[model samples]
Target: MDVAEAMTLLLSPQGRLDPYPAYERLRAHGPVVEAWPGLHVATGYAVIDEVLRDPRYVVSYEPLPQTTVAGWAESPAVASIARSMLRANPPDHGRMRQIVAGAFTPRRVAALREVVTAQAAALVAAMAERGRDGTTVDVLDAFAYPLPIGVICALLGVPEADRSAFRTWTADLTVVLEPEISEAELAVADRGAVALRDYFRDLVEARRRTPADDLTTALVQAHDAEVGRLDAEELLANLVVLLVAGFETTTNLLGNGLVVLLGHPAHAAALRDNPDLAGAYVEELLRIDSPVQVTSRISSVPVAPGGVPVPAGGEVLLLLGAGNRDPERFADPTRFDPTRPQNQPLSFGGGPHYCLGAALARLEARIAFPLLLRALPDLALAGEPRHRARLTLRGYATLPVTTVTRPHQATGVEPRRTVATTSAERRRIARVSAGERGTPTGAGPGTP
Candidate 1:
């Protein structure tokens, strides 16, 4: 299918279940395929990597025209968020990232592992308590989606009572890939933005009155020390982004990783048997079904992504999802094999614009995955899994699962199932690193 036709499938409800074939068609066409008149898409591994690493490929350019989303036009909250590091380039992006980076530092992320483990265990126990024996549970609602969201809410000091309402706002804002979002959707997005802002305004006020040992309080202190570093609006925007990004992405990662595992029992059994393989298994899962599928960029100057020249101001969609499944780069690319030794994937983007929350996201997944598997060895899909409708972030809307009862113990252990890592795994990692994409060791327990 052509890029336009593929986009139609992509936007349609059914396409979410299987976007790979369409992506493969786009990749087969060339490195660069124009999805829309002003938009160019890079699908292959090399092309996506090149554009991501290219300094000219602007990170924060406005992805769509003004008329695309009415909420973006009407809401200053939306604009403030769009003005964040994700949409800004160079000095601004670097400055914004640095301010927040201290909190998400490697050490801080490592420290968060204990928090993640405790949270995951508590959540699983809660799920068990609320759900009866063999009762159906929506993984997305109960486990997958809630894990990271809960952690972030506590970290950001968002009150427990407001999270459900705030989640609605985040969901409405996430459907930005639409060509023309309706006035209703725009209103939803607008209201969500307002509610979040109001909530944060109150939060900022509380922090100022009585400082706490939390990220928001620290940021408020920084703002006071250095004027223009952050304002009420920017602070709220970053907070909202942190919540949305943390909640949605890691939820999908856990959900999708579980899906991949259940499909491959041997790997699941191996993980159940040998806990040491937890980190490697997570990396392979990330490679197979990346949570953040595509990241958009804009060309500032004349540039060619994989020899396809993109004019200035043109849009480029780096299909990291597709790049991860390229046959040229990975052997049996479509297979869900945990033992893939050369497991380098662009689930996290490349270069200066690489995901800062990557560390936290990985930590959440690593801790969450093992805990779930250990809690319910017989856990499997209870019903059909429905994926969320969006080409941008690939994940499930509802993942129904049933957990089998297992007696609680001090330390859980199971049979070991070992499979050698494929040669393709090492090569893929080397290739991705040679291009300066992602952190070393592919993915570890603490972070990316």
Candidate 2:
């Protein structure tokens, strides 16, 4: 199938698990192609980077029917949540991004280094224990999904006790990030919205009463006389955005990173030997696998960049993962080499609205992955790992795996039982290695 057709098929439930080959085809067809009416797809590296840096291109949904009509009409609750920099265009985007940036300064993220590392260690320990019974574990549910939620909760001053329920709220609000949806999905979206608003309202009230040092309180208090203070609606919206963006995107990164590591044992061994390499490998993983697979933008005026005209009000979908792997930009685009120096991957995006949480996401991955591989060097997918149902937000629903060493052994204590495997199991692993695979299952990473 052609790139457009393959993209359509990949968006279907059947192809979500693996859409990489489709992305390759799209990249080959041209740097830019039309996915559908009012929607153009850009797969080339320079084009994708340009789209992000271009001041004319807007991120606001106000111009698109997706946000103005279907998005808000179906779920009225999104009005407040979607007003932040994430969904805003230029001046509005600039203003909101500035305020949010103050709260998420690189200095602040740097302070989180030790805390993130500790969290990684603890979660890896828990995962190792959970697999003690010789039962397989889904990395998504067990570790990758929870790490960022917990970290963000800690940063936002949301009590650790509420992490689980708060995670559900994050999940519900991000459903729109999926490829396509039906009217019934809107109802579900409503429940998610209501739950999210209520949770944030209560949390906001608590923060207001006792002005703590969390991001929410910081935003509420920063500037003269709360100049940038968000009302209850705006507060909830921004919180939902932070939670959803920080939570899912990092999870996809960790998940996709693990898939890459497991698929390439040499890299895995290298990581096992030099945990410090994780600092650089995380970017390459994100570059090669590109956790955030696709980015959608709208053209404001008639502009031609790649022999393709994007008229006013037209939509463009930048296949960032494809761009990162474009052979025109990177030699050996298919290989997952962590040592590449020119790793200028657009995984965290480019330009003004680039991911505010990029630093935090990288910190989480760098701390989490090496710790995980060290604890369970023998970790491999247990069942036929499957991707989630959604398309817009790429990631796996399940990644069942059996750790090599027992919990005790993994923790550097004495082994309670020998890590066992048979010749047949080795052959099965080899078969999996040799099989012809398409794209990865799940949203193609970088989903939030």
Candidate 3:
């Protein structure tokens, strides 16, 4: 396919379901191909990596008045996402990142290992209980969705009862992150943004009155500190950014990881046999099937990536999903190998834009996956998995899985096993197990 056809396919629901072939076609055309005037697509591993790290490349841009809607431009969702560090550049981005980082310290994230393990185990046990009823459990809801959301809510000092509401708000608000979305969707996102902002405003005030040992309280204190701190808008925007970024990608990672493991029994067995390999397995999963598929950067000045000149203000779409699977960067790029050596997938954008929550995401996946496997050894697919029709942030909409409970041996303990059996059983299982179904299942080097 030509660049135009390829770009069209890449954005379609079917394309989002399996964009690897299109990526390969694009990579064959060149590392950097112009998709349209002033818009270039980067598919090569080295090129995407370089573009992300290049100082001249930026995330912020000034929208032309002709292209923007007057009132829509000022919408809460648009304003918050646009002003947040995720979309900012230079001094502003650095300042916002620094202040947020002060509270999101490594020590603080590292301290959540026990919490992640317990939460993962509890969720998996709950799934196991559902399996006992002979009912298929939606893994996305029962396990993948709750784990990261729970952890992030706990970190932010959000009450458990309020988390479900946040989940709905985040789901609606996340559509704003996509480059292509409907006006109707934008309206929903705007409402979610306003609700989130108002909710956090009250939360921040409460924290200020009574500081607590949580990131939200710490951020509130930083905002109210003597000097060089966040303004009210910046504080609220970053908190929203943190809440969404913290869980959305990690949720995808958990869902995609399970799909991959269940599809490859050998790999699943390996992980079950050596739970310590969870770290390596998580890395490979990230490399093979990244949660965030694409990120863009704008050229601040004339610059060349892959020896092709991009003029000042040109936009380059970094096809991170393609970069992770670039043949030159990975051996047998299409294959999922948990034990692959020296894996360095750019699932997380490189340099200053590298995901701030990388460590926490890794911690969640590492602790959760092993606990999940150990808890539900007989896990198998129950129905066809559904993919969310999102090209930028790829993940399952629903993953129906069942845990086959085997008869206990004389020791009153059931041995670990997989559940693929007869033609009917296999058919039912095959309907949802990654490769067996039409769903795209994989991720890149880190939990995005």
Top-TM-score candidate index: 3
- What is the lDDT of every predicted structure here? 0.69, 0.68, 0.75
For candidate 2, lDDT tens digit of each residue in 220-285?
553224555444455567777777787788888898789889988999989988988988899888
Which stretch of 10 consecutive residues in model 3 shows the poorest summed lDDT?
A: 439-448
Residue 184 in model 3: lDDT: 82
Number of clashing pairs per prediction, in order: 4, 14, 10
RMSD of each: 8.6, 10.5, 9.8
User: lDDT by residue for model 1 over 1-448, one digit each (tens)?
Assistant: 6778877776566656677877887877876787878788888888888888889878645532356544465564455467565666777666556665655556556766655665567567655544447788887777776677766665565555667776577777766544335677667667767777777778888988986545566567766768877665557777667677767778889989998888888878888777778888888888899988888778889887777778998888878889999888889999887778778789988887777778788778878777777777777888789887766778888888887554244223211211111233223322222222221222222111
TM-score of each: 0.87, 0.85, 0.88
Q: Which of the two, 1 or 2, has more TM-score?
A: 1
The TM-score of predicted model 2 comes to: 0.85
Model 3 CA lDDT for position 429: 22
Deviation of model 1 at 134, angstroms: 1.5
